[model samples]
Target: MNTFSRRRFLQAAGAAGALALGAAACGGDSGSGSGTGGASALTWWDHQLQLQPAKKRIFEKFAKAPGGMPVDYTFNNPEKLGQALQLAKQSNQLPDVHSNAGLQVPAPQLINEGWMAPLELSSEAVANLKDVLLDGIHIFDGKVYSFPIFDYHVYTNVTWFNTKVAEQAGLDPSAPPTTYDTFRAAARAVQSKGGGAAPWTWNIGMTERTADQLNYLAQAAGFEGNTGMLFKNGEFAYHDDAYVDSLDFLLSLKKDKLMMAGSESWVDTDARGRWSAGAACYYFDGPWCPGVVLSAAPQFAESLGVAPILTPSGGAVRTYHGPQSGDYWLTPKSKHAEAANKLLSDYFTTPDYSVEVANTMSQPPRDLDAVEKSTAHAEYKKLIGWFRDTVFLAPTPVVKNVAITKVQVETKPVEPNLGTIIQGAFTGDVPDVKAALKKLSDDSSAERERAIKAAQAKGAEVSLDDYAFPDWKPGADYTLDQYK
Candidate 1:
């Protein structure tokens, strides 16, 4: 049985529930007492991604404000926080400041319900957020809402190849493939050796893995729009031809037997193991794999190589140019907004604290001064340098009903069912591409209509267009004739 729907949907459900709890934990209203009257205690809630760094900043560095009261912190994962906060809301254990990845599972609901305090980064802080670092995380309605942890992503995908395998295949390891054709050619050459494992290994089970696979192919083929958000010209277009073609290309890869055997069964750990065992010539994944590599096969680090995904169109998709991983800290209608901001400013901007935080988590510092001051600079140089020079930080998509996005990401109905329609087409369980595409187009249309109606009820206007997938010449990104 396919685990795709189950895994993705379960995540969405958990996330939705988590956000609900986050909202409840920090009640919609500021309570009866002002934190300033006495020794104010601030509670900080954040995800575990940057735990050590956060702990170092708050516990060791900023616990006491000059002569003021210290912070009281509780750490939890975003998932646990959701559940815990809901209970806390009832018991009045809500935190003063919460840090979480902006635009993640809990943020949408929190934003919709007005459970979060609006963050106005002072001019000094805003000026520090220049193009040198990634921006656009703490934004809603074109105003800042939270302070982002870091400006560069640690999860950007890299194209990695095995030198020995490439050399044995009589291919230049340094001049690796730069297009789908070349990439496939390299994989085939490596596979022909008949001695090692599969030629290519990649993330197959994760949602982002699926999305990234589709993104690499679609962008290489020249699709110039967001796959997740089929919105354009103030409307959502799920029936776009490029969207269809993206699915088709992914299905073609599976059908061609070009991917690793049992790829669909492989998760990150399994895939990483395959790469570390010298089982594949190429591994397409994020840079965080270095840690896995170190643990799995330390020697693999020396042999490791990294490069951006090749585009058939010779244009970069700018994956490295976006916001880095980690959460943004938000104040939830705190009685201590001023105190909270001061702590946040010191926590995020101070060189000693910022460098300490960035170094601890291997995250690129958001403050240029902090980044420049660090002696452990080489650790995050690649992640920061590429993002600084090439990435374009854009605003997160305004998902009107995050529940729908969650549902869409997670589960699909069986056969004639609506949710699993896209997966069916890719898996060849659906016999006709045209019919499957048509049904998908129809389902998306219905979803858009429902979304528009819902938005209208909330006193907002929305229009949606169908997402389309178009045909294109092999190796061409996108062309006029590709669309009808």
Candidate 2:
């Protein structure tokens, strides 16, 4: 929707900036059980989600004097997590640990099928993770399941805008559109300004994007639907009238041409590019988006304006943000489970280590002291305040059967690609709203059934109710109002 370059951020931001730090992993032949003080050789399978500098810094930190047992580390693209896990299971060579896409699709299923071992956290550990892990994300049967790994925390409909565009459109560059009325009006004003540039960029094309867009709208409607894959339960309902109304509202914006034509196909990176280049007046995104923009287009930094999402009813949905995974350390089904435990325990609890990790990755650490030292810590402090004060950080849902979930999405393809799905619905591509919704519902239900059958074949007992989490019925007995 918006066309910006990423090269600028790459050149300006320290190569080491925004690096992701992970637990010390031990693996490979050089690492033997001979080391008593450290973990034996254990391989850590990671999806290299960070830029080069961050990765190098992280490896350098772990490149110690072969600490008792050398931990072999490796990183791959995130999409490989599932395939890699499957291959590992078949080969019996699963890494000592790996990251999971928490609270989405397959994660919950895997957890339910006992594919993951519950984390047995001590009182101290639990306290250490309070903010990062939150109370609801990691607990299972009153016991800690997965260690909260990370979260992609932020609010919905909120984006980083180009001050230049705002000024040209007769909007105050310094102020954000705090209410939906103002926001919509600004969109029209930007359009009226009539530059080749667009007023807004959206990511509503795919099922995931569509879902997220709808979720944000639902939240705006004062409904609490979780955007994460594990979205289920009483806090939010998928089939509520508000859910449909929110979709309708968004479609209205599309019909009015206030949003970009290709809103759906654009991913997070694409959206940032558009904003960084001053291609649009506004770009809907989270806080991390600003970092990405600043890194890629520092020249546009002064022109960028950040704000929270606006609600049509004048109600605000507190921003929801977190590390992508929420802080997880899995005990690989290995003979070295004990050593793995020790390394992870030391890694997470080490105040100094946490500080370094947080600083390197440009993230807020779970540890209070560590978080205080981050380079971006001050801004993160503001973000944390936003989370604590202005935002309600909802616990992302974790679904069961991640693999089956993947198959479902691919099989039940969205119309004209993901972007078209959103644009089409809103632009009158599919005039019949009820029919389109029914199609979506039917696809989702079929996918769920497929997942159920697959789990059953694996000797897993998963009920439909358990599968549908964070989702609530509109006028039904269960509603998000209870939590508020």
Candidate 3:
């Protein structure tokens, strides 16, 4: 769910994930009595509302639990939590433990900037979380920071449909088409006959998703890895056939009038709300959509059916996910690092907590075995099946060369990036999709080269070669061993 999850948040989340908490307590002030409640109470910040019940049960019993301390827990949506954290960081106040949500920078940079502390965990704690650990992701420079709390095989393009609408369109809800042409045809059927609502809908108004949707759609077009940079070589491929054709497919939906009205202005939740109420036939989303739909459109629950994103000509699809990363992090400034580590290492990683994480379903646990005893909804559990069976774990430049962090740190953003290019394409600001994509690819590569030179100047041994992974395959996990 990265396009919808953590990694793909590289954009619009620029500031939105910081809502109430951004202005509320200024980050529990490291659990000081001034912000949280009382002295020595560990303040925790996260945006995972679905995990609230599990977290609450733990916090309520925490003081009595191992590594337990009085916890001052705060929850907000991603935007608000991020805002609060950024504000807190600026003010020199950060929570003892918080999820790595809003700050979209690479984890290594986060640590280098003093936004994180090396989690001084016991050897036993490290051993317990070892199976889920990855270098450059949870661990950096020989120190453990955090381990993955969620599964890695996830993406943004899970195709969800309203059963009622499928029947109305004379398509099988249980077995929707997986081919691009067939899927588009089916969408057209839905528009012409399925309740007179838009055939398909998404929050196109959210520019970031346009980029993300294109990311996964490129896979459906039979491309491998992320659309940002082709993993086969250390080069940007924005104008490559995969991305250009994928964008063309998206543009066709708009030109053919299959997109929902107001989609141009709808945010994700709004589009989901409308889709839930039978206003659209299909809503292309992520594994987490079922949970969101359950809350945002409860009545749509029984009528909902989820399937993997369709591929062009049903080409075997492989929606790749970036390396696993820890959600929770600690600010080095916190006075309660030990207590925070205890909470994270001693308690949070336990099978009991994992079962709770599985039960939440909005965010899947790193190990699907946790689902064996989870009480998650059938729809939620079904989505998990797709994630396990279809998604791929891809190699990362960070893993290939940890020094890549310096390049990330030095590389500044280029204007009219993928998101803006997609926006311009749809709004007719850019009439030549291929040309725009080529320019984007070239510009990004140039920026990266300059960044590499800049980082080398600073004595960080890195280069564009760090981005290439020649041994990577289409359908398998690109584990650490494959990096070199």
Best by TM-score: 3
- Residue 218 CA displacement from its true place in model 3, Å: 0.7
Model 2 scores worst on lDDT over the 10 consecutive residues at 17-26
* Model 1 segments more than 4 A misplaced: 1-59, 63-108, 113-144, 150-157, 162-171, 228-249, 291-299, 313-326, 331-343, 349-446, 461-484
Ranking by lDDT: 3, 2, 1
Which stretches of model 3 miss by more than 4 angstroms? 1-41, 63-67, 79-81, 122-124, 295-299
Instruction: Estimate the Cα RMSD of every predicted model relative to the unseen true structure.
Output: 11.4, 11.7, 7.3
lDDT score, candidate 2: 0.48
Worst 10 residues of 3 by lDDT: 17-26
| Candidate 2 lDDT tens digits, 1-484 | 1111233222211111000112111001111121112245566665423322343454445545234245666554333344555666677666665554211333334554445555544455544545333222343323444454333333435545787888888888657776667878888989998376788876543234345555665565666444312234422234456556666666666668887767655555455566568777787654445444544455765676766566666653543432334344463366656545555554554555556544543333445355456654233345544444444444322223223323332233333332344556655576765556556555555655675576667655444544343443332333222222
Q: What is the Cα-based TM-score of model 2?
A: 0.63
Q: Rate the local accuracy (lDDT) of all candidates.
A: 0.47, 0.48, 0.70
- Model 2 ranges with Cα > 4 A deviation: 1-55, 65-95, 102-108, 111-127, 130-145, 149-157, 192-195, 224-241, 296-300, 316-326, 329-343, 349-373, 377-383, 393-431, 434-484
Name the better of 1 and 3 by TM-score: 3
For residues 1-484, write the lDDT of model 3, one tens digit per residue. 0112222221212211101111111111111122444456888877665566677787778788766788887775453456677888999878888876545566666777888876766555655565665445665655667766667767777788888888988988878767768778989889778878788887666555557678888876877668578878867888879888878887898899988877766656678778888889888776667665564446766798877787766756678877557777888888888787777766677766778777766556767778768877776687787778778887778766767767777877787878778878877898999999999989998988998999999999777777888888888888754653
